[model samples]
Target: MSETEQNGEVTAQLVDGSTPATPEALFEKLDALDIPHRTVEHPPLYTVEESRSLRGELPGGHTKNLFLRNKKGGMWLVTCLEDRAIDLKDLGERLGGYRLSFGRPERLMQYLGVIPGAVTPFSVLNDHQDAVQMVLDSALLNHDPLNFHPLDNARTTAISPKNLLKFLEAVGHYPQVISLD
Candidate 1:
């Protein structure tokens, strides 16, 4: 079946269907959950600087997602304001010991099914093993809407902050809200 048709059928099944396996499939999951969102297709963004140029066109609280792992292999997906300063040393303490480092590209793909620039909470849908812990910056949560790449840096998806939590829960991820300030 065509991608569009598959997505349509997936939406028809709602939350009863399996997790989305592709970026397009992710949208289908969102639709199935009745969560409102806006997607803007744009040039691929690898860094915050590249994405900043499109800020005017996209309205919402933008996020930068980090995939981190400790020496013990405890993995975390941290999402915060695009401009927020994250002190890995401090965050490591909060997350419980052993200094955290960015998970390798291959590891990211294995866990989140996304490339480096595409890391987002939405990627958790691809984590069928439920191995990654999710963290949301309390500062970013104050915003009504949140924006992140939808498993692909070429597109940005915006959804209300409350809906983000709902989406995370639907995907079996329990997000920890912490102050990254």
Candidate 2:
């Protein structure tokens, strides 16, 4: 938090002081792995439209994360470009998650440890039980720096696609990369 380093990741607590999934903890993990990242704080964003409005032209692959559960209670965290259209039925067939449905808020917190608007692969940090599978869109990997909420919607973090995979593997949640057509 210096003059020249404005807009950098500060490793701070979430507004609610939530445990096991705070931005502070995520930042610490990123730092420990020597994964270089840049983060900027802005007005809390709950939608793609709001992100574009407030985050104006941030260079990178802007992402939207989905928390889905299959009929068998299996869960997945899907990260794709904000503009990517997802057909849940097709996705379920492809991922072998037939009859997929959005996880309830309570289940979302139970698994990924984040609220609806705050869902992101980074929340897998709190997936201590490794109960959720991570699915990454192949198109997202083409972008040099991919952007995601750092366990909260008020801030966004940027990292290289390679580093993202590295961080995920380090955390024991290696993602299944697929093209979501």
Candidate 3:
């Protein structure tokens, strides 16, 4: 592992001068994992409110993914339902007092290979080093088909909660589930 990896730089090179996985490449990986997913291409959505416009056309539970880091430079990707309320301070307390803050856009791209609007658990596909910790809300499991951007905000992909976990494990990002109750 590189020093960057030790410091939680997930977007580092993939072995030897290789590039991060593209959205299409990520889809292929999911396919290889035998993870069933349905995707819809539409206008780019940068916020939950923007995604609301497609509620009628896009069915299933949508998600909001956060790329965060702690004072110690530990990285975390938290995914929960789009409408779920989040109290960062409280969450930080629950997660071992991380002093959490949103990761910088450059680091996000470098690690997850995605911009602010495109952050998703799928971005882990780019983190070949497993440098980022994954945090998932248990409530999201109640939804049969969970929706997320496939490393791009221009499209949304739906997959079963079980399959999501399976895919994450396959990619070496086993989630740490939390209940928001």
User: Per-residue lDDT tens digits of candidate 2, residues 63-103?
Assistant: 99999998798889999999999999999999974878998
Task: List runs of model 1 lying over 4 Å from the truth.
Answer: 1-20
lDDT of 3 by residue, 90-178 (tens): 88999897688889887787678788899999988888777899999999999989999998899999999999999889889999999
* CA-RMSD of model 2: 7.8
TM-score versus the correct structure, for each prediction: 0.87, 0.88, 0.88
Stretch of 10 with least lDDT, candidate 2: 10-19
**Between prediction 2 and prediction 3, which has the larger TM-score?**
3
In model 1, what is the error at residue 117, expressed in angstroms?
Answer: 0.7
User: What TM-score quantifies how close candidate 3 is to the native fold?
Assistant: 0.88
List per-candidate RMSD values in Å. 6.3, 7.8, 5.4
Sort the predicted structures by TM-score, highest score first.
3, 2, 1
Kindly list the per-residue Cα lDDT of model 1 for residues 128-168, writing each as its tens digit.
87889999999887886788898889999999998999999
Give the winner by lDDT: 2
Clashing pairs in 2: none
Alpha carbon lDDT at 143, candidate 3? 90
